[model samples]
Structures are given as structure tokens and as C-alpha cells.
Target: MFKKFLAIFTLTFSLINVALADQANPQVVMKTNLGDIKLELYPEKAPITVKNFLDYVDNGFYEGTIFHRTIAGFMIQGGGFTQDLERKEVRDPIKNESANGLSNLQGTISMARTNFPDSATSQFFINAVNNYNLDARGRRPGYAVFGKVTDGLDLVVRISRSPTAPKGGHRNVPQQAVIIEKIERLGSESKAN
Candidate 1:
């Protein structure tokens, strides 16, 4: 009877640990027409940015969005415009978290903002190559790096390589819009190994 009780306690402890581990750093899966892009967000590093992004995902704000801008060898930007070039309303811009010690390296995802440093809303970009210029340094306010693509990087490349043209005064718009089907928080079991 003592052995049985010990086994039950051990199993319960293991399950609780797993749940806590998954909650610490969340994972998200972004399904696009091109392919599935899995991301591992760093809430510990960029807490505000990660929270904003996850809130957007949870609210279904990324559904039916398109990759509006894709610059080969640079990055692919999306999560703001629709397939018909219509801009969607987003929450107020969050504070700049560029000094979070995260670099805009290849496969890393960063927020896309206007000239204002703290004007990042729902738009984000995935770096196709090392983009050191986007990293905060000295007095420069660089884009905030919050997460990275753990899978479907080749799909990101494919979308970046797609034909682009000017549309609705927006340059580098993909001719064939790569629509974002949906983005959701990945289950703990689905996290990247």
C-alpha cells in the first residue's frame, strides 16, 4: 500500500511540473498558405511583446491576414493587412522592448513599426538572414525581437521568394497573397524539441 501511494504522488508531481514548464514559455503555431510556421516565444526576455503577440493570436487577429511585404534575403512582414489590401484595426502600440538582449538573427521574429520606436501593433516580420541593423544599440531604437521560427523556415523562404509588386501604395506586396489561415498557441505536447 505504501508503494502504491508513492507511485501516485510521483505521477501527480510529474504532471504538475509539465504543466508549469509549458506555461513558463509558450509556443505558437502559425498556419499560412505557404506552410506551418512554429514559433517559440520568449516571455522571459520580452514579456510585453510576447504578451501582446499572444493576445493577438488568442483574439484571432491574424486570421485571414496576408504577408503584405516580402523582401528576399531580408524578411517577410505580415499580420496587419488582409488579402484584399485592407488594413485591419489593431490595439494601441506597445512600448519598445528592443533592449531585451534578443538579436534579430535569421529565423527570429520581430515587430514591425513605423518611424516611431514604440509604434508596434500587430504587424511582425521574420528575418530570413542576420539583420544586425535591426538590433538596438547605443541610442538607436531597434525593432523588438520576441520569438523565432522553430519550423517551416523553408516555407518562410518560399513566401519571401514569391513575386512581389506595388499595391495600394504599398511596395513589395506579394503578387499572390500568402494568406495566414490561423495562429494559435501550441499545446505543450506540440512544442518543438
Candidate 2:
């Protein structure tokens, strides 16, 4: 009887491990002119946002897009405009998943939006500091925090602190336009683990 129970426990553990491994581990390598930022996406927590971001990445929509908004000690916004100041029109807006319980912490990635909650459409921001004010359940429905910078956060910080000037009808755009050269998945082997 004890042997049977042990076998059952082992099987359950194996099943749990397999279940976890079967889930897609979406990772993004943001190749910026300043540096590259590696991020591990959380699809379980923010499925819609992750799907949308991955769709854009897969379609090569983020390449050459400039980091259009940069505010020292605030956040870096981008994934919309090109170095030539042309905007990439994105698909329909996504429903705000800010209530996903993710905090807008430093180095975290969140969807950018207007006053409306469902206005997040491709543009995203990287938090420069612990922005508790941007978390859901606040006065305003907060931005949808989806992922965190697993690597290259220093590069993100440096870009956030870069000098800026108004461009494309938006303020705080980097004078030279810090562009995202490319975005790619690291590898299947690395992601599988």
C-alpha cells in the first residue's frame, strides 16, 4: 500500500512538471541602438497582452520603431513610430488587463494607453522605477503590466535617461530617436527550459 501511494505521488509530480513544461515560455530580445533588453513574457497572467505583443514581434512590426517617449526617472515608451517619424498603425485595441495583479515595478513592461482602459494598441512602456501609482485598483484604471526585464535593465535605464525633444506630435522623444533595430526569440532550447 505504501509503495502504491509513493508511486501515485511520483506520478502526480511528474505530471505537474510536464504540464509546466508544456506551457509556452515566450521571451523577447529587444535589440535597441543603446543595448538589448531581454524579457520573459508572462502569458498565464496577461494572455491577451502577451499574445498581441508576440504577434507584433513575429510579424516584424517593432523593427526600426523609435523609442518615442523618454523621461528621466519615469519610463521609456515606444513600439509605434519609426526612425523616420512614421507611425506604424497597429491592429484594434486590446482590453486592459491591468487587473492581472502585476505591479508596475521598475524594469517591468506595461501597455501604454490614453485615458481609456481599452486603448492599449501596440505601444508599451518600460518602468524606470517602482510605480505603484500605475498599478490597477488605483484612482484610474492602470496600465497593463505584462512582463519584466529579465536582463539588460541597465540599458533600459540608460535609454530612459537619454536626452529628448518633441517629435511626431509627442513630447520627450529622443532627439536622435533611440530605435529598436530588431526583436527576436532567443531560441527554442533556451525557451523550453
Candidate 3:
């Protein structure tokens, strides 16, 4: 009986550790029409931004969204507009977390916002080149860098190279819609992501 109890306790402890490990730096995969982009979020560095993104992912908010804007050598932006160029309603704006020390380097994903700081909602962008200019500059609140592409970065580059034109009053809109099929957390039962 003593040996059996010890074995059960060890198993439970191991499972608990696994759960905590997964939560430490949760992984997600953004399924875009161009291709799949695997991302690793830095919850420790940008907890609020990461939580906001995960909340959208959990709610399937990105389904069928289009990578509306793509600028060569700049970045590919998406997650807010649909393929039809209609803007989706999003949750309230999140606080700026760009001072978390993360840079806007190539392959890194950052929250997309307007000229007004602290207005990032559901839209996000992936840097195609090192975009250090977007990093926090002292008092200026820069775009928040919450995650980076762990795999399929080549897909991001491809999306950035897409042909673009002005559409629906938005500039640099992709002529060919680059749709986001879905975004899912990596370690669920469908760990395929």
C-alpha cells in the first residue's frame, strides 16, 4: 500500500509539472492561407498582451480574417478585417506593453495600433525585417511585441511579398486575400498545431 501511494503521488506531481510547463510559455499556431505560422508567446515579458491575444484565439476571432495589409520589406498585418474588407468588432483596447524589452525584429509579432498609443485591439503584424524603429522610445509607447514566430517564418516572408493595392480606404491592402483559417493553442487534444 505504501509503494502504491508513492507511485500515485509521483504520477500526479509529474502531471502537474507538465501543466505548469505548458502554461509557462504557451505555444500557438496561426493558420493562414499562405501557410502555417507557429508562434511562442512571452507571457512573462508581456502578460497583458499575451492574455489578450490568447483570449481572441480561444474565442476563434481570427477565423476567416484576412492579412489585409502587406508592405514589402516592412510587415504583414492582419486579424481585424475579413476577406471582404469588413472590419470586425473587437474587445476594448489593451494597455501598451512595448516597454517589456522585446524588439521589433524580423519574425517577431507585435500588436497593431493606430497613432494613438494603447489602442491595440485584435489586429497584429509580423515583422518581415528588423523594425527597431517600432520599439519603445523612452516616453513614446511603441507597438507591443508579445510573441515571435518559432516555425514557418518563411511563410511570413511570402505573405509580406504579396502584391498589394489600396482597398476600402486602407493602403497596402493585399490584392489577393491572404486568409487566416484559424488560430489555436498548441497543446490541446488536437496538438497538430
TM-score of each: 0.85, 0.84, 0.85
For candidate 3, give the lDDT of residue 157: 91
Candidate 2: stretches off by over 4 Å: 1-24, 189-193
Give the per-residue lDDT digits (tens) of candidate 1, residues 1-193: 9999999999999999987865667888999877899998998889999999988888889999999999999999999998888999999999999999999999999999999999999999999999999999989999999999889899988888889999999999999879999998877524222
RMSD of each: 6.1, 4.7, 6.3
* Model 3 lDDT on a 0 to 1 scale: 0.91
- Output the lDDT of residue 53, model 1: 91
Q: Write the per-residue lDDT of candidate 2 for residues 1-193, one digit (tens) a residue.
A: 9999999999999999976754456778999888899997888899999989888888889989988999888899999888877888999999999999899999999999989899999899999888898888855688999898989989888888888887658889887668899888776723221
For candidate 2, the per-residue lDDT at 165 reads 81
**Overall local distance difference test of candidate 1:** 0.91
TM-score of model 2 relative to the true fold? 0.84
Predictions in order: lDDT: 0.91, 0.87, 0.91
> What pairs collide in candidate 3?
none
Number of residue pairs clashing in candidate 1, backbone atoms closer than 3 angstroms, sequence gap of 3 or more or interchain: 0
Which consecutive 10 residues in model 3 have the weakest lDDT in total?
A: 184-193
